[model samples]
Target: MTTLNTHPTTAPATSAAGGGGSLRRVLWAAQILLAAFLLIGSALPKFAGQSDAVRTFTDIGWGQWLRYVTGTVEAAGAIGLVVPRLAGLAATGLIGLMGGAVLTQLLVLEPVWSLLPAVFAVVFAAVAWDRRAESRQVLRSLRRAPSRTP
Candidate 1:
């Protein structure tokens, strides 16, 4: 009888030699910290209408409503980032949001200002890519679920 190795391979590649695995773990820790910091920092100010956030949004010429929408989205993404099962989806959402932020800054703010959002977009993209396999598994399982149509 033949047996299959059914163990799930959900983790990113990590070399057991030369401390490469430890390095990967460190990088992942930094990524999580960066995501939490950026998202929460962006979200809270908009929710509370802090002076800096309000002024920046005002300069963008969009109504205050945009601020609230962005804050809520950022908060949601931040929460999702810490959840093991949802990090990939959260990172994906953050990438799109940060892309919009970068474009807005490019058009309405100093060119240098756009770089911050652009950096966030890149980091989020990396997170999404690292989790791609897990995300694919999640997608497959969802697809296999029975539809609830009456």
Candidate 2:
């Protein structure tokens, strides 16, 4: 009987050789930092009843409740970024949230600085995309049969 090579083929290593891992780590760190910053900077002021923050939230018609909700989500997403299994999903959720923020700023606020949200959204989207292939590989490995569990 002819023996078959059962070993799986590895993807060309170069696909991830050019700074992909380091870049992905940096992106994850940056996303976590941004989430923390947003949570503290925006949330604190609203929670503290600062005049400018209150006025801005009021004028936006979204109210303080929305601020609380957003801050909580950001904090949760930031925490999730550090966990490998949850990172992809968290990044995806954060990107969606940031995209919504960008749209709100564009349509409702119409400020030139509104682009910042979109920029952040793009960064998070990149992070999610870069990690996706690896995440899939990991999932596939997990689903594979356990070798002779004794």
lDDT of 1 by residue, 48-123 (tens): 8899999988888888889899999888888877765666788899899988988888888887889988887887
lDDT of 1: 0.77
lDDT of 2 by residue, 12-114 (tens): 3222326745676677678677767766775566567788777766777977787667767777777666665566667788888888787777777766757
Residue-pair clash count for candidate 2: 0
Error of 2 at 100 (Å): 1.5
Clashing pairs in 1: none
What RMSD does each model have against the real structure? 3.8, 6.6
Against the reference, the lDDT scores of all candidates come to 0.77, 0.69
Query: How many residue pairs in model 1 have overlapping backbones?
Result: 0
TM-score of each: 0.79, 0.67
Best-matching candidate per lDDT: 1
